[model samples]
Target chain A: MNLAQPIYARVKDHILAQIRSGALVAGSRVPSENELVSQFSISRMTANRALRELTADGFLSRVPGVGTFVREATPRTSLIELRNIADEIASRGHHYSSRIEDLREMMATPNLIDDFELRATTPLYHIAIVHEENGMPVQFEDRYVNPFCAPNFLKQDFSHQTPTAYLLSLLPAEELEHNVEAILPDANQQRRLKISSSEPCLSLHRRTWSGGHVVTSATLIYPASRYALYSRTSLGKQTS
Target chain B: MNLAQPIYARVKDHILAQIRSGALVAGSRVPSENELVSQFSISRMTANRALRELTADGFLSRVPGVGTFVREATPRTSLIELRNIADEIASRGHHYSSRIEDLREMMATPNLIDDFELRATTPLYHIAIVHEENGMPVQFEDRYVNPFCAPNFLKQDFSHQTPTAYLLSLLPAEELEHNVEAILPDANQQRRLKISSSEPCLSLHRRTWSGGHVVTSATLIYPASRYALYSRTSLGKQTS
Candidate 1:
C-alpha cells in the first residue's frame, strides 16, 4: 500500500487488467524481464519479482527454456468439494423439497450377496426420493440404507425431513467417501427433472460408513446447467 | 460374505449387478418391497436393507407418492487433490519438462499501480513457461513475479530448475490462496496444447502471497479429457 511495497504486485495488476479486458488474449506472451525493465524504467529485480509472482498465481505459464505466455481462462470449474445440496440451494434463497417415492424392505439378491459379503437371505431397506429446488426438480435421490445402522428410518417422514438429517441423528459417521461426475440424463430423468434431452446432468455417487459398516450409499443427480461444484485447498488441513 | 454381515451391502450389490448386466434397463422401476420379499422369501427387514443401501449408493430412486425406480448409472467422478502438477505427472510414470518462453523486467501499468498500490512507474518482472509430460503438451503456465519478495530470481537458471522450486528455495512461504476453473480452449491454446476445438479444457487460477505482499499469481490449463478435479472433506472441522 506504500512505496516500500514490492514492484511485483504493481506489475501483476497491470498484466491482470490486460487479461480481464481481453487486450492480452489467451496464449499471448507478455514482454520479457529485460523488456519490462526498459519499458518501465525499473530495476531488473523489480521486474523479475512481478513475473515470478504471476507465474505462481496461475495467470501465466513459464517454461524453463521457452518463454512466458498467457493462460486460458476457465469458467465454472473449481476443485470439487463435498457439500450438502440442500444447504447449497437454500443458501441461494430457494425452496428445497423432497418427495419420497417408495420405501420397503426386501431380500438381498445374488450380486448383493457377493458385494456385501452377505448370506443368501440378508434383509435391507431401499428408498427413492425426488429432490426439488424452487419447485424445479434438481436431483433424484436413489438411496440404499443399512437398517441396522438406522433402525427407525422407515417411520420418519422424509417429505419434511431429509434422510441425510435423519440418518445423522440416528447414527454419527466417522468416515465418508464421495464421487461426482457429468452424464447424459435418461428419459425418466428428463421427464422428472423437466429437463430436455440436450442438457447434460451432474451426478454424485456417495458412500458413507459408521462403526465399520457401510451406513449408506446414494446417487444424486443434478441438471448440469443448475449446479457447479466448488472446493479450496491449503498446504495443511486449513479450509476456506 | 457371511450371515453376520449387514444385509444392505448385499442388496446394493445385487441391484448394481442387475443394472450392469442390463437386466434392469435405465428408467425402469425396480420391484416393490413386497415383491422382493416374496421373491427372495426373506424377511421384510432383509429386503428393506438391500433397497436402502442401493438407494444410498445411487442405484435406485424412490418417490413417496409414486414408486421405487431404477436410477441411471452415472460415472463415479473423483476430485484430483491439489498438489504440484509436476508431482502429479511424475506419479503417473512420465518425464516432465518445462521450457522457459520469456523473461523480462518492466514498469507497472495503470492497473498494476492501483492493485499493488504502487507508484505509476514501479518496475516488475514477467515470465512464461510451458510444461510437458513425456513431450506431450499439457499445461501452459504464465506467471508474474514480485521481485521485491525474491530479488535474485533473475539470476536463477530456470532451465535447470522450476520456478516453484527456485522461489521456494529463496523464500519460504507461510500462507497461500488458490482459485480453479474450467473453460473452452482458445485458438492459441488449441494449437499449443494440440487439443481439438471440440475438447473442453480445465484451467486453474491461483494466487499465493507471503507477509501481506503478493508473491505470485498464475494460470494453469489442461485438456478436459485428460484430467478431472478432486477434493475431500471432513465433518470434524464443521462441528468443531
Candidate 2:
C-alpha cells in the first residue's frame, strides 16, 4: 500500500485487489466496517468511506439489512434499454409469437453461479425461447433466473408472457447492465434462427437488478441480417 | 390506397410507397400540404395529419420554416448510450491518445449522400482517427460530417481534442441513432486496429441529429479482444 495515497483509497484498492484476484467472488460478503478498520488499522470513517465509494462505483452492493457483497463484475449498470422482442415486432404491425424451447429448473453450473452471483448447486430457472415476427424467427433468447429473485419463476407459464415481463412484475428493475458482441451462433441457434453459419449474429448479454439483488442474466441472439441493437447519446457531460 | 383505410392513412401510404420505390430519396422534399391535397384529392387536415405522423415516426424531418423531407431510413433512435472512448480509458487510469490518419473535404459518395441525407456531390468533411490507450490502438473511428452542421469542421486540429468533443461544442445533439454489428474488418480497418482477419471487430454505426438535421455519421470499429461496448439501462418505460 502506498503511504502517500489517502487511507480510504488504499482501503478501497485492497478490496478491489481481492476482487481482481478472485479471492472474493460475487455474492460473497466483504469485510465489514469494523473488520476493515481493525485489519487496516484505519479509522472507522476511513473504512466506511471506502465501502461507500466501492458501492457507488458498482464494485460492491450493500443490502440495507444484509451485508455488503461483491457484485458480478460483468453485470454493471446498463446503457441499453432491455426492450421486449414482442413489443418491437408489434410496433411494426407484424404478428409476434414465441415458442418455448426449454424451461426447467437446474443446478447452477460454475458459469451460472458466476453470472447470477449465487452459490454452486443453487437451483436456477433456465429458459430458452425463440421469438418470431410474422412467423419468422428473429431472436433466440436464453436466460437464467436467480431463484431468490423470483421464487416462482419455474412455475410460470412463459408462453402467455415473456420471462422479462414476468420478472418485472415480481420486482420492478432498478438497474440493468449490458454487453454487445458479434459472433457465429452454434448449430442449435443457427437452426432455430434459420440463419447460415456464415451469417454473423448480434449477441446481447443483459443483467437486471432489483432491490439490490440480481434478478436475471440473459443472452439474446439475433440474426444480424434482420435485427440490430440501438442506442443514442443523451445531451450531457461526456463520461463513461 | 385501400378505400377501407382512413384518408390520412391512405395519404401516408402513398408517400411511403414513393419513398420505398426510390422515387423519393433522403433529403428529397415531400409534397407540400397543398400539393398533397390537390394530388391525393384530400382535405388540408388529412394531408397535415399524414405529414405529422410520418415526421413523428422518423420517416420525415420537418424544418421549422422549411418543408418536410425524407429521413435516412437506417438512422432511427438508439438503444445504447454513446460514451466517449477517451473517458472510458481515463476512468481506468490509463493514458488515452488519438492519431489522426486522414482529414479532408470530399464530395459525398452515393452511400455518403444517403447517410447524410444530403444532395449528391455535396461536400462533406471526412475524418479517420485511431484512439489508443497506453499507446495501444483500440478503436478506429471513420466519420463523415455534414458541412451544413459544421461549416468550419476542416479548420480544427483534432490532435489536441476529439472530434466528438468539438462536434458537441458546435451543436448539442438532440437525438442519436446507433447500430451495433460484429464483423470481419476490412484491410484498412485491420491495419489501423492492428488486428488480424481472424479476429472479429465490434462495429458501431452512429448518427446524431440536432435542429432537425443530421450532424454526422460515423462507424467506430474496435477489436473485440481489447474492447466492448457497454451501456446501463435507465429506469423508464421501455420504448425505442
TM-score of each: 0.51, 0.62
Query: How does the DockQ of candidate 1 come out?
Result: 0.04
Question: A113, model 1: CA deviation in Å?
Answer: 9.3
**Listing every candidate in turn, what is its Cα RMSD in Å to the true structure after a full C-alpha superposition?**
24.5, 25.2
> What are the fnat scores of the candidates, in the order listed?
0.07, 0.58
The digit string of per-residue lDDT tens for model 1 on B1-240 reads 023545545555566657655788768988877877887777777787677656644567788867678765432222443256677788999998877778888777775554343444567677777788898887877666777877777788876677776766665443354444335568988877888765656565555544345676666776756654443444342231
Q: Which ten residues in a row have the lowest lDDT in candidate 1 chain B?
A: B73-82
lDDT of 2 by residue, B60-95 (tens): 977666888998654111235445677656634467
Q: Which lDDT tens digits does candidate 2 get at residues A99-149?
A: 999999988888877677554468888999999999899999999998887
Best by TM-score: 2
Give the true-structure RMSD of model 2: 25.2
Top candidate on DockQ is: 2
- The CAPRI-style docking tier of model 2 reads incorrect
